[model samples]
Target: MEFVILTGLSGAGKTNALHAMEDSGYYCVDNLPPLLLETFYDLCDNSTDNRMKKVAVVADARSGEMFADIPEVISKLRLEGKQFKILFLDAKPNTLLVRFKGTRRKHPLIGEIASGSIEEAVELENELMNGVKAMADYVIDTTFMNPNELMERVTTLFSAGAHDTLLVTCVSFGYKYGLPPEADMVLDVRCLPNPFYIKELKPLTGLDEQVRNYICGFDVMGEFLDHLYAFIDYLISLYRNEGKSELVIGVGCTGGKHRSVTVARMLNTHLLENGQKSAIHHRDIWKA
Candidate 1:
Protein backbone atom coordinates (compact mmCIF):
# COMPACT_ATOMS: atom_id res chain seq x y z
CA MET A 1 0.00 0.00 0.00
CA GLU A 2 1.39 3.40 -1.01
CA PHE A 3 0.31 6.31 1.18
CA VAL A 4 0.90 9.95 0.51
CA ILE A 5 -0.04 12.83 2.81
CA LEU A 6 -0.52 15.96 0.73
CA THR A 7 -0.16 19.05 2.88
CA GLY A 8 0.54 22.66 2.06
CA LEU A 9 -0.38 26.29 2.59
CA SER A 10 -3.81 27.28 1.34
CA GLY A 11 -3.92 28.73 -2.23
CA ALA A 12 -0.71 26.84 -2.96
CA GLY A 13 -2.36 24.17 -5.16
CA LYS A 14 -3.00 21.36 -2.67
CA THR A 15 -6.44 20.73 -4.17
CA ASN A 16 -4.90 20.75 -7.65
CA ALA A 17 -2.26 18.28 -6.49
CA LEU A 18 -4.92 16.03 -4.96
CA HIS A 19 -6.89 16.13 -8.21
CA ALA A 20 -3.77 15.15 -10.16
CA MET A 21 -3.20 12.25 -7.76
CA GLU A 22 -6.79 11.15 -8.24
CA ASP A 23 -6.30 11.10 -12.01
CA SER A 24 -3.13 9.09 -11.47
CA GLY A 25 -5.21 6.31 -9.84
CA TYR A 26 -4.86 7.23 -6.16
CA TYR A 27 -7.88 7.03 -3.89
CA CYS A 28 -7.93 10.63 -2.68
CA VAL A 29 -9.50 12.55 0.20
CA ASP A 30 -9.49 16.32 0.45
CA ASN A 31 -9.20 18.57 3.52
CA LEU A 32 -8.72 15.66 5.93
CA PRO A 33 -7.76 16.78 9.45
CA PRO A 34 -4.22 15.83 10.48
CA LEU A 35 -5.39 13.58 13.32
CA LEU A 36 -7.26 11.20 10.99
CA LEU A 37 -4.12 10.14 9.10
CA GLU A 38 -3.78 6.75 10.77
CA THR A 39 -7.47 5.94 10.77
CA PHE A 40 -7.75 6.86 7.13
CA TYR A 41 -4.87 4.55 6.28
CA ASP A 42 -6.39 1.80 8.41
CA LEU A 43 -9.69 2.02 6.56
CA CYS A 44 -7.93 2.02 3.21
CA ASP A 45 -5.78 -0.96 4.16
CA ASN A 46 -8.78 -2.94 5.37
CA SER A 47 -10.64 -2.51 2.11
CA THR A 48 -10.67 -5.53 -0.24
CA ASP A 49 -10.31 -3.37 -3.32
CA ASN A 50 -6.72 -3.07 -4.52
CA ARG A 51 -7.55 0.43 -5.72
CA MET A 52 -8.02 1.49 -2.11
CA LYS A 53 -4.44 0.69 -1.24
CA LYS A 54 -2.88 3.67 -2.98
CA VAL A 55 -4.21 6.69 -1.13
CA ALA A 56 -3.46 10.41 -0.87
CA VAL A 57 -5.02 12.85 1.56
CA VAL A 58 -4.93 16.61 1.77
CA ALA A 59 -4.23 17.83 5.31
CA ASP A 60 -3.50 21.49 5.66
CA ALA A 61 -4.48 24.82 7.29
CA ARG A 62 -8.08 24.15 6.31
CA SER A 63 -8.25 21.94 9.41
CA GLY A 64 -7.94 25.06 11.63
CA GLU A 65 -6.20 24.49 14.98
CA MET A 66 -6.21 20.73 14.42
CA PHE A 67 -3.70 21.24 11.61
CA ALA A 68 -0.99 21.57 14.27
CA ASP A 69 -1.35 17.86 14.98
CA ILE A 70 0.42 17.07 11.69
CA PRO A 71 3.90 16.65 13.11
CA GLU A 72 2.62 14.46 15.93
CA VAL A 73 0.86 12.12 13.51
CA ILE A 74 3.96 12.05 11.31
CA SER A 75 6.08 11.04 14.29
CA LYS A 76 3.60 8.40 15.39
CA LEU A 77 3.36 6.91 11.93
CA ARG A 78 7.14 6.85 11.67
CA LEU A 79 7.48 5.24 15.07
CA GLU A 80 4.91 2.60 14.13
CA GLY A 81 6.83 1.75 10.92
CA LYS A 82 3.86 2.90 8.87
CA GLN A 83 5.15 3.77 5.41
CA PHE A 84 4.06 7.09 3.92
CA LYS A 85 5.46 10.19 2.24
CA ILE A 86 4.50 13.80 2.70
CA LEU A 87 4.25 16.31 -0.15
CA PHE A 88 4.27 19.96 0.82
CA LEU A 89 3.27 22.49 -1.78
CA ASP A 90 4.11 26.14 -1.29
CA ALA A 91 4.29 29.43 -3.17
CA LYS A 92 5.72 32.87 -2.48
CA PRO A 93 3.53 35.12 -0.32
CA ASN A 94 2.92 37.51 -3.19
CA THR A 95 1.92 34.70 -5.50
CA LEU A 96 -0.34 33.21 -2.86
CA LEU A 97 -1.84 36.62 -2.09
CA VAL A 98 -2.56 37.21 -5.75
CA ARG A 99 -4.15 33.78 -6.03
CA PHE A 100 -6.40 34.33 -3.01
CA LYS A 101 -7.44 37.77 -4.18
CA GLY A 102 -7.95 36.59 -7.79
CA THR A 103 -10.15 33.76 -6.60
CA ARG A 104 -11.90 36.18 -4.20
CA ARG A 105 -12.04 33.68 -1.35
CA LYS A 106 -11.12 34.17 2.29
CA HIS A 107 -8.03 32.33 3.41
CA PRO A 108 -8.68 29.21 5.47
CA LEU A 109 -6.89 30.76 8.45
CA ILE A 110 -8.29 34.26 7.99
CA GLY A 111 -10.44 34.31 11.14
CA GLU A 112 -7.94 32.35 13.20
CA ILE A 113 -4.99 34.72 12.84
CA ALA A 114 -4.62 37.99 14.75
CA SER A 115 -6.15 41.18 13.25
CA GLY A 116 -8.32 38.86 11.09
CA SER A 117 -6.35 39.84 7.99
CA ILE A 118 -5.66 37.44 5.11
CA GLU A 119 -2.05 38.65 4.99
CA GLU A 120 -1.51 37.83 8.64
CA ALA A 121 -3.31 34.54 8.12
CA VAL A 122 -0.96 33.59 5.31
CA GLU A 123 2.09 34.35 7.42
CA LEU A 124 0.73 32.47 10.42
CA GLU A 125 -0.18 29.43 8.38
CA ASN A 126 3.23 29.49 6.76
CA GLU A 127 4.84 29.48 10.21
CA LEU A 128 2.56 26.69 11.43
CA MET A 129 3.22 24.52 8.35
CA ASN A 130 7.00 24.78 8.74
CA GLY A 131 7.14 21.79 11.10
CA VAL A 132 5.49 19.38 8.68
CA LYS A 133 7.27 21.00 5.74
CA ALA A 134 10.57 20.11 7.39
CA MET A 135 9.37 16.50 7.63
CA ALA A 136 8.17 16.35 4.03
CA ASP A 137 9.66 13.87 1.57
CA TYR A 138 8.93 16.35 -1.20
CA VAL A 139 8.37 20.11 -1.19
CA ILE A 140 7.16 21.73 -4.36
CA ASP A 141 7.30 25.48 -4.86
CA THR A 142 4.38 26.09 -7.14
CA THR A 143 4.90 29.85 -7.31
CA PHE A 144 5.38 30.01 -11.06
CA MET A 145 3.87 26.71 -12.12
CA ASN A 146 0.78 26.46 -14.24
CA PRO A 147 -1.70 23.74 -13.42
CA ASN A 148 -0.36 21.34 -16.09
CA GLU A 149 3.22 21.84 -14.98
CA LEU A 150 2.34 21.19 -11.35
CA MET A 151 0.35 18.12 -12.28
CA GLU A 152 3.30 16.78 -14.29
CA ARG A 153 5.77 17.29 -11.45
CA VAL A 154 3.50 15.70 -8.83
CA THR A 155 2.74 12.81 -11.16
CA THR A 156 6.42 12.25 -11.86
CA LEU A 157 7.29 12.16 -8.16
CA PHE A 158 4.61 9.55 -7.26
CA SER A 159 3.93 7.61 -10.43
CA ALA A 160 4.11 3.84 -9.88
CA GLY A 161 4.95 3.10 -13.53
CA ALA A 162 3.70 5.39 -16.26
CA HIS A 163 0.52 5.38 -14.20
CA ASP A 164 -1.65 7.53 -16.45
CA THR A 165 -1.26 5.35 -19.52
CA LEU A 166 -4.38 5.13 -21.67
CA LEU A 167 -5.32 1.44 -21.68
CA VAL A 168 -6.49 0.46 -25.16
CA THR A 169 -8.71 -2.52 -25.84
CA CYS A 170 -9.23 -3.38 -29.52
CA VAL A 171 -12.02 -5.70 -30.50
CA SER A 172 -12.70 -7.25 -33.89
CA PHE A 173 -16.37 -7.95 -34.60
CA GLY A 174 -18.38 -8.79 -37.70
CA TYR A 175 -21.09 -6.34 -38.75
CA LYS A 176 -23.45 -9.33 -38.92
CA TYR A 177 -22.85 -10.05 -35.22
CA GLY A 178 -23.58 -6.44 -34.13
CA LEU A 179 -21.30 -3.82 -32.59
CA PRO A 180 -19.41 -4.17 -29.34
CA PRO A 181 -21.25 -2.32 -26.56
CA GLU A 182 -18.02 -1.36 -24.83
CA ALA A 183 -16.46 0.37 -27.83
CA ASP A 184 -15.61 4.02 -27.39
CA MET A 185 -14.41 4.28 -30.98
CA VAL A 186 -15.46 2.10 -33.87
CA LEU A 187 -13.83 1.75 -37.30
CA ASP A 188 -15.24 0.01 -40.29
CA VAL A 189 -12.66 -2.01 -42.23
CA ARG A 190 -15.44 -3.50 -44.35
CA CYS A 191 -14.10 -1.30 -47.18
CA LEU A 192 -10.83 -3.26 -47.03
CA PRO A 193 -10.34 -6.28 -49.27
CA ASN A 194 -11.49 -9.62 -47.92
CA PRO A 195 -9.02 -12.51 -47.73
CA PHE A 196 -11.86 -15.05 -47.43
CA TYR A 197 -12.34 -14.93 -51.21
CA ILE A 198 -8.96 -16.57 -51.70
CA LYS A 199 -9.20 -20.37 -51.30
CA GLU A 200 -5.92 -20.73 -49.35
CA LEU A 201 -6.55 -17.63 -47.21
CA LYS A 202 -10.20 -18.59 -46.62
CA PRO A 203 -9.22 -21.52 -44.38
CA LEU A 204 -6.87 -19.36 -42.29
CA THR A 205 -7.85 -16.71 -39.79
CA GLY A 206 -6.05 -13.34 -39.53
CA LEU A 207 -3.67 -15.00 -37.07
CA ASP A 208 -2.06 -16.96 -39.90
CA GLU A 209 0.97 -15.38 -41.57
CA GLN A 210 -0.41 -16.08 -45.07
CA VAL A 211 -3.67 -14.30 -44.36
CA ARG A 212 -1.84 -11.33 -42.88
CA ASN A 213 0.42 -11.20 -45.92
CA TYR A 214 -2.57 -11.35 -48.24
CA ILE A 215 -4.23 -8.48 -46.39
CA CYS A 216 -1.05 -6.44 -46.46
CA GLY A 217 -0.47 -7.10 -50.19
CA PHE A 218 -2.91 -4.39 -51.27
CA ASP A 219 -1.65 -0.76 -51.58
CA VAL A 220 -4.94 0.39 -50.08
CA MET A 221 -4.18 -1.48 -46.82
CA GLY A 222 -1.01 0.52 -46.23
CA GLU A 223 -2.74 3.83 -46.94
CA PHE A 224 -5.67 2.96 -44.70
CA LEU A 225 -3.39 1.92 -41.85
CA ASP A 226 -1.34 5.10 -42.13
CA HIS A 227 -4.38 7.34 -41.94
CA LEU A 228 -6.05 5.36 -39.14
CA TYR A 229 -2.86 5.26 -37.07
CA ALA A 230 -2.36 9.02 -37.40
CA PHE A 231 -5.97 9.73 -36.53
CA ILE A 232 -5.88 7.44 -33.46
CA ASP A 233 -2.56 8.91 -32.37
CA TYR A 234 -4.00 12.43 -32.33
CA LEU A 235 -7.18 11.31 -30.58
CA ILE A 236 -5.20 9.40 -27.97
CA SER A 237 -3.05 12.42 -27.12
CA LEU A 238 -6.18 14.51 -26.61
CA TYR A 239 -7.88 11.86 -24.50
CA ARG A 240 -4.78 11.07 -22.47
CA ASN A 241 -4.06 14.69 -21.61
CA GLU A 242 -7.72 15.04 -20.56
CA GLY A 243 -7.22 12.10 -18.12
CA LYS A 244 -9.03 9.33 -19.91
CA SER A 245 -7.58 6.01 -18.81
CA GLU A 246 -9.40 3.45 -20.92
CA LEU A 247 -10.37 3.27 -24.58
CA VAL A 248 -12.25 0.48 -26.34
CA ILE A 249 -11.83 0.57 -30.13
CA GLY A 250 -13.98 -1.73 -32.24
CA VAL A 251 -12.81 -2.80 -35.70
CA GLY A 252 -15.56 -4.14 -37.86
CA CYS A 253 -15.76 -5.90 -41.23
CA THR A 254 -18.24 -8.05 -43.08
CA GLY A 255 -16.88 -11.05 -41.17
CA GLY A 256 -14.72 -10.88 -38.02
CA LYS A 257 -12.66 -13.87 -39.22
CA HIS A 258 -10.33 -11.86 -41.46
CA ARG A 259 -10.04 -8.10 -42.10
CA SER A 260 -11.41 -6.87 -38.80
CA VAL A 261 -9.19 -9.24 -36.86
CA THR A 262 -6.17 -8.17 -38.87
CA VAL A 263 -6.94 -4.47 -38.39
CA ALA A 264 -7.53 -4.77 -34.65
CA ARG A 265 -4.34 -6.77 -34.21
CA MET A 266 -2.48 -4.17 -36.23
CA LEU A 267 -3.86 -1.32 -34.12
CA ASN A 268 -3.04 -3.15 -30.90
CA THR A 269 0.49 -3.84 -32.10
CA HIS A 270 0.94 -0.21 -33.06
CA LEU A 271 -0.10 0.97 -29.63
CA LEU A 272 2.07 -1.58 -27.82
CA GLU A 273 5.07 -0.70 -29.95
CA ASN A 274 4.60 2.91 -28.95
CA GLY A 275 4.73 1.91 -25.26
CA GLN A 276 0.98 2.08 -24.76
CA LYS A 277 -0.86 -0.80 -22.99
CA SER A 278 -3.21 -2.47 -25.44
CA ALA A 279 -5.18 -5.71 -25.91
CA ILE A 280 -6.87 -7.31 -28.91
CA HIS A 281 -9.97 -9.51 -28.90
CA HIS A 282 -11.36 -11.23 -31.98
CA ARG A 283 -14.94 -11.31 -30.78
CA ASP A 284 -16.46 -13.13 -33.70
CA ILE A 285 -13.46 -14.94 -35.16
CA TRP A 286 -15.11 -18.33 -34.69
CA LYS A 287 -18.57 -17.30 -35.84
CA ALA A 288 -17.72 -18.37 -39.37
Candidate 2:
Protein backbone atom coordinates (compact mmCIF):
# COMPACT_ATOMS: atom_id res chain seq x y z
CA MET A 1 0.00 0.00 0.00
CA GLU A 2 1.32 3.43 -0.92
CA PHE A 3 -0.34 5.89 1.46
CA VAL A 4 0.45 9.56 1.26
CA ILE A 5 -0.66 12.22 3.70
CA LEU A 6 -1.02 15.48 1.77
CA THR A 7 -1.12 18.53 4.04
CA GLY A 8 -0.43 22.18 3.40
CA LEU A 9 -1.39 25.77 3.93
CA SER A 10 -4.36 27.03 1.92
CA GLY A 11 -3.78 28.31 -1.66
CA ALA A 12 -0.61 26.21 -1.97
CA GLY A 13 -1.84 24.28 -5.07
CA LYS A 14 -3.03 21.24 -3.17
CA THR A 15 -5.96 20.76 -5.59
CA ASN A 16 -3.65 20.64 -8.61
CA ALA A 17 -1.24 18.35 -6.79
CA LEU A 18 -4.07 15.95 -5.97
CA HIS A 19 -5.16 15.89 -9.62
CA ALA A 20 -1.63 15.00 -10.67
CA MET A 21 -1.56 12.27 -8.08
CA GLU A 22 -4.88 10.95 -9.39
CA ASP A 23 -3.54 10.92 -12.94
CA SER A 24 -0.49 9.09 -11.62
CA GLY A 25 -2.79 6.28 -10.42
CA TYR A 26 -3.31 7.32 -6.84
CA TYR A 27 -6.82 6.98 -5.42
CA CYS A 28 -7.42 10.49 -4.09
CA VAL A 29 -9.67 11.75 -1.31
CA ASP A 30 -9.79 15.45 -0.55
CA ASN A 31 -9.99 17.10 2.89
CA LEU A 32 -10.30 13.94 4.95
CA PRO A 33 -10.08 14.35 8.72
CA PRO A 34 -6.77 13.31 10.28
CA LEU A 35 -8.56 11.17 12.83
CA LEU A 36 -9.87 8.94 10.01
CA LEU A 37 -6.39 8.11 8.77
CA GLU A 38 -6.12 4.69 10.35
CA THR A 39 -9.72 3.75 9.66
CA PHE A 40 -9.44 4.88 6.05
CA TYR A 41 -6.25 2.92 5.56
CA ASP A 42 -7.90 -0.16 6.95
CA LEU A 43 -10.86 0.28 4.59
CA CYS A 44 -8.70 0.68 1.55
CA ASP A 45 -6.40 -2.19 2.44
CA ASN A 46 -9.35 -4.48 2.92
CA SER A 47 -11.10 -3.36 -0.28
CA THR A 48 -11.08 -5.78 -3.20
CA ASP A 49 -10.27 -3.20 -5.87
CA ASN A 50 -6.61 -3.34 -6.87
CA ARG A 51 -6.58 0.36 -7.72
CA MET A 52 -7.18 1.31 -4.10
CA LYS A 53 -3.82 -0.14 -3.12
CA LYS A 54 -2.03 3.08 -4.05
CA VAL A 55 -3.88 5.82 -2.19
CA ALA A 56 -3.20 9.49 -1.51
CA VAL A 57 -5.41 11.68 0.68
CA VAL A 58 -5.49 15.33 1.64
CA ALA A 59 -5.48 16.03 5.38
CA ASP A 60 -5.10 19.67 6.25
CA ALA A 61 -6.27 22.91 7.92
CA ARG A 62 -9.59 22.62 6.17
CA SER A 63 -10.23 19.66 8.40
CA GLY A 64 -10.20 22.31 11.14
CA GLU A 65 -9.46 21.07 14.68
CA MET A 66 -9.56 17.46 13.50
CA PHE A 67 -6.26 18.12 11.75
CA ALA A 68 -4.48 19.07 14.98
CA ASP A 69 -3.30 15.54 15.73
CA ILE A 70 -2.03 14.51 12.27
CA PRO A 71 1.59 14.30 13.41
CA GLU A 72 0.67 11.65 15.99
CA VAL A 73 -1.37 9.72 13.39
CA ILE A 74 1.56 9.72 11.00
CA SER A 75 3.81 8.44 13.73
CA LYS A 76 1.40 5.59 14.46
CA LEU A 77 1.26 4.64 10.78
CA ARG A 78 5.09 4.51 10.72
CA LEU A 79 5.23 2.39 13.87
CA GLU A 80 2.74 -0.06 12.39
CA GLY A 81 5.02 -0.48 9.36
CA LYS A 82 2.40 0.97 7.07
CA GLN A 83 3.72 2.36 3.81
CA PHE A 84 3.45 6.01 4.82
CA LYS A 85 4.69 9.16 3.20
CA ILE A 86 3.72 12.76 3.91
CA LEU A 87 3.91 15.53 1.32
CA PHE A 88 3.69 19.09 2.59
CA LEU A 89 2.87 21.79 0.05
CA ASP A 90 3.61 25.41 0.82
CA ALA A 91 4.18 28.85 -0.70
CA LYS A 92 5.42 32.27 0.32
CA PRO A 93 2.87 34.15 2.43
CA ASN A 94 2.75 37.00 -0.07
CA THR A 95 2.17 34.61 -2.93
CA LEU A 96 -0.57 32.82 -0.99
CA LEU A 97 -2.26 36.16 -0.30
CA VAL A 98 -2.09 37.03 -3.98
CA ARG A 99 -3.58 33.67 -4.98
CA PHE A 100 -6.52 33.96 -2.60
CA LYS A 101 -7.18 37.51 -3.71
CA GLY A 102 -6.99 36.68 -7.39
CA THR A 103 -9.30 33.71 -7.02
CA ARG A 104 -11.66 35.63 -4.72
CA ARG A 105 -11.69 32.79 -2.25
CA LYS A 106 -11.91 33.07 1.50
CA HIS A 107 -9.11 31.45 3.45
CA PRO A 108 -10.08 28.49 5.63
CA LEU A 109 -8.40 30.12 8.59
CA ILE A 110 -9.77 33.63 8.13
CA GLY A 111 -11.84 33.34 11.31
CA GLU A 112 -8.71 32.61 13.31
CA ILE A 113 -6.99 35.71 11.93
CA ALA A 114 -7.84 38.52 14.36
CA SER A 115 -7.20 41.35 11.92
CA GLY A 116 -9.22 39.56 9.20
CA SER A 117 -6.28 40.01 6.88
CA ILE A 118 -5.62 37.22 4.38
CA GLU A 119 -1.88 37.87 4.68
CA GLU A 120 -2.12 37.39 8.41
CA ALA A 121 -4.28 34.34 7.77
CA VAL A 122 -1.44 32.89 5.74
CA GLU A 123 0.99 33.51 8.58
CA LEU A 124 -1.31 31.83 11.09
CA GLU A 125 -1.85 28.81 8.85
CA ASN A 126 1.91 28.51 8.33
CA GLU A 127 2.48 28.52 12.06
CA LEU A 128 -0.21 25.91 12.59
CA MET A 129 1.18 23.60 9.91
CA ASN A 130 4.73 23.49 11.33
CA GLY A 131 4.41 20.14 13.13
CA VAL A 132 2.92 18.31 10.12
CA LYS A 133 5.41 19.97 7.77
CA ALA A 134 8.28 18.71 9.91
CA MET A 135 7.03 15.16 9.36
CA ALA A 136 6.85 15.55 5.55
CA ASP A 137 8.81 13.17 3.39
CA TYR A 138 8.58 15.74 0.58
CA VAL A 139 7.81 19.45 0.60
CA ILE A 140 6.91 21.50 -2.46
CA ASP A 141 7.15 25.29 -2.46
CA THR A 142 4.82 26.48 -5.24
CA THR A 143 5.49 30.19 -4.95
CA PHE A 144 7.07 30.33 -8.38
CA MET A 145 5.28 27.44 -10.14
CA ASN A 146 2.22 27.62 -12.40
CA PRO A 147 -0.52 24.97 -12.15
CA ASN A 148 1.06 22.90 -14.91
CA GLU A 149 4.50 23.19 -13.36
CA LEU A 150 3.13 22.16 -9.99
CA MET A 151 1.28 19.16 -11.47
CA GLU A 152 4.46 18.22 -13.30
CA ARG A 153 6.33 18.22 -10.03
CA VAL A 154 3.75 15.94 -8.43
CA THR A 155 3.78 13.62 -11.46
CA THR A 156 7.59 13.54 -11.38
CA LEU A 157 7.51 12.35 -7.79
CA PHE A 158 4.78 9.70 -8.17
CA SER A 159 3.92 8.85 -11.80
CA ALA A 160 7.03 6.79 -12.52
CA GLY A 161 6.64 4.92 -9.28
CA ALA A 162 3.08 4.00 -10.21
CA HIS A 163 3.82 3.14 -13.86
CA ASP A 164 1.29 5.79 -14.88
CA THR A 165 0.86 7.12 -18.41
CA LEU A 166 -0.02 10.63 -19.57
CA LEU A 167 -3.73 11.12 -20.34
CA VAL A 168 -5.07 13.13 -23.30
CA THR A 169 -8.66 14.17 -24.01
CA CYS A 170 -9.69 15.56 -27.41
CA VAL A 171 -12.90 17.59 -27.47
CA SER A 172 -14.86 18.72 -30.52
CA PHE A 173 -17.17 21.75 -30.38
CA GLY A 174 -18.91 24.39 -32.50
CA TYR A 175 -17.51 27.89 -32.80
CA LYS A 176 -21.01 29.39 -32.81
CA TYR A 177 -21.73 28.21 -29.26
CA GLY A 178 -18.46 29.10 -27.55
CA LEU A 179 -14.92 27.90 -26.97
CA PRO A 180 -14.35 25.10 -24.53
CA PRO A 181 -13.31 26.76 -21.30
CA GLU A 182 -11.16 23.81 -20.24
CA ALA A 183 -9.20 23.34 -23.46
CA ASP A 184 -5.45 23.40 -22.95
CA MET A 185 -4.94 23.67 -26.69
CA VAL A 186 -7.51 24.50 -29.36
CA LEU A 187 -7.43 24.03 -33.16
CA ASP A 188 -9.80 25.50 -35.71
CA VAL A 189 -11.08 23.14 -38.42
CA ARG A 190 -13.29 25.73 -40.13
CA CYS A 191 -10.78 25.57 -43.01
CA LEU A 192 -12.05 22.07 -43.82
CA PRO A 193 -14.85 21.63 -46.39
CA ASN A 194 -18.18 21.78 -44.58
CA PRO A 195 -20.45 18.79 -45.05
CA PHE A 196 -23.29 20.97 -43.73
CA TYR A 197 -23.56 22.64 -47.15
CA ILE A 198 -24.22 19.32 -48.93
CA LYS A 199 -27.94 18.44 -48.75
CA GLU A 200 -27.54 14.69 -48.09
CA LEU A 201 -24.57 15.08 -45.74
CA LYS A 202 -26.11 18.07 -43.96
CA PRO A 203 -28.68 15.86 -42.27
CA LEU A 204 -26.02 13.36 -41.21
CA THR A 205 -23.56 13.63 -38.33
CA GLY A 206 -19.77 13.44 -38.81
CA LEU A 207 -19.91 9.83 -37.62
CA ASP A 208 -21.85 8.87 -40.73
CA GLU A 209 -19.74 7.16 -43.38
CA GLN A 210 -20.99 9.40 -46.22
CA VAL A 211 -20.15 12.62 -44.35
CA ARG A 212 -16.73 11.27 -43.36
CA ASN A 213 -16.12 10.06 -46.92
CA TYR A 214 -17.12 13.40 -48.41
CA ILE A 215 -14.84 15.29 -46.00
CA CYS A 216 -11.92 12.88 -46.50
CA GLY A 217 -12.45 12.85 -50.30
CA PHE A 218 -10.81 16.29 -50.48
CA ASP A 219 -7.01 16.59 -50.96
CA VAL A 220 -6.85 19.42 -48.42
CA MET A 221 -8.25 17.25 -45.60
CA GLY A 222 -5.73 14.42 -46.08
CA GLU A 223 -2.87 16.91 -46.03
CA PHE A 224 -4.37 18.76 -43.08
CA LEU A 225 -4.78 15.59 -41.04
CA ASP A 226 -1.23 14.54 -41.81
CA HIS A 227 0.02 17.87 -40.53
CA LEU A 228 -2.38 17.94 -37.60
CA TYR A 229 -1.42 14.48 -36.42
CA ALA A 230 2.28 15.29 -36.65
CA PHE A 231 1.85 18.58 -34.81
CA ILE A 232 -0.15 17.00 -32.00
CA ASP A 233 2.24 14.07 -31.76
CA TYR A 234 5.13 16.46 -31.31
CA LEU A 235 3.21 18.58 -28.80
CA ILE A 236 2.17 15.53 -26.76
CA SER A 237 5.83 14.55 -26.53
CA LEU A 238 6.70 18.00 -25.20
CA TYR A 239 3.90 17.79 -22.64
CA ARG A 240 5.15 14.35 -21.55
CA ASN A 241 8.68 15.69 -21.22
CA GLU A 242 7.33 18.27 -18.82
CA GLY A 243 5.72 15.38 -16.83
CA LYS A 244 2.14 16.47 -17.44
CA SER A 245 -0.25 13.63 -16.67
CA GLU A 246 -3.10 14.91 -18.82
CA LEU A 247 -3.69 17.29 -21.75
CA VAL A 248 -6.96 18.53 -23.26
CA ILE A 249 -7.03 19.40 -26.95
CA GLY A 250 -10.07 21.00 -28.53
CA VAL A 251 -11.06 20.90 -32.22
CA GLY A 252 -13.62 23.43 -33.37
CA CYS A 253 -15.57 24.13 -36.58
CA THR A 254 -18.47 26.29 -37.69
CA GLY A 255 -20.84 23.53 -36.56
CA GLY A 256 -19.54 20.69 -34.38
CA LYS A 257 -21.84 18.06 -36.00
CA HIS A 258 -19.52 17.77 -38.99
CA ARG A 259 -15.91 18.78 -39.57
CA SER A 260 -14.81 19.26 -35.98
CA VAL A 261 -16.08 15.85 -34.90
CA THR A 262 -14.38 14.12 -37.82
CA VAL A 263 -11.10 15.91 -37.15
CA ALA A 264 -11.25 15.23 -33.42
CA ARG A 265 -11.92 11.55 -34.06
CA MET A 266 -9.10 11.36 -36.55
CA LEU A 267 -6.75 12.97 -34.07
CA ASN A 268 -7.88 10.61 -31.30
CA THR A 269 -7.46 7.51 -33.50
CA HIS A 270 -4.09 8.72 -34.65
CA LEU A 271 -2.95 9.12 -31.08
CA LEU A 272 -4.08 5.60 -30.17
CA GLU A 273 -2.41 4.04 -33.23
CA ASN A 274 0.78 5.85 -32.34
CA GLY A 275 0.63 4.29 -28.85
CA GLN A 276 -0.50 7.44 -27.09
CA LYS A 277 -3.18 7.54 -24.38
CA SER A 278 -6.18 9.44 -25.68
CA ALA A 279 -9.96 9.84 -25.49
CA ILE A 280 -12.50 11.98 -27.37
CA HIS A 281 -15.80 13.79 -26.72
CA HIS A 282 -17.96 15.71 -29.22
CA ARG A 283 -19.29 18.54 -27.11
CA ASP A 284 -21.96 20.05 -29.41
CA ILE A 285 -22.63 17.26 -31.86
CA TRP A 286 -26.27 16.70 -30.90
CA LYS A 287 -27.24 20.35 -30.68
CA ALA A 288 -29.41 21.93 -33.38
Report the lDDT of model 2 for residue 217. 97
Q: What does candidate 1's lDDT look like per residue over 1-288, in tens digits?
A: 888889988998988788888988898888888888899888887999999888898888888899888899899998998877788898889889999999999998888866878889889988999899888766666765678767866775566533336667777888997776557889999898899899978978888888889899999989999999999989989988876655678899887889998989999999989988676667788876
- Model 2 lDDT tens row, 1-288: 777878898999999999999999899999999999999999998999999889999999987777788889888987997766777888878889889999999999888877898888788889889999877766666765579877876786677553356667777889997786556889998988999989888989888989899999999988888888888889988988886656778899987899999988888898889888776777788889
What's the count of clashing pairs in each model shown?
0, 0
The worst-scoring run of ten residues by lDDT in candidate 1 lies at: 156-165
> What are the lDDT figures for the candidates, one per model?
0.83, 0.83
RMSD of 2: 10.4
Which lDDT value does model 2 have at 25?
A: 89
Error of 2 at 203 (Å): 55
Q: Point out where model 1 deviates above 4 Å.
A: 161-288
* Leading candidate by lDDT: 2
Model 2 residue runs over 4 Å out of place are 162-288
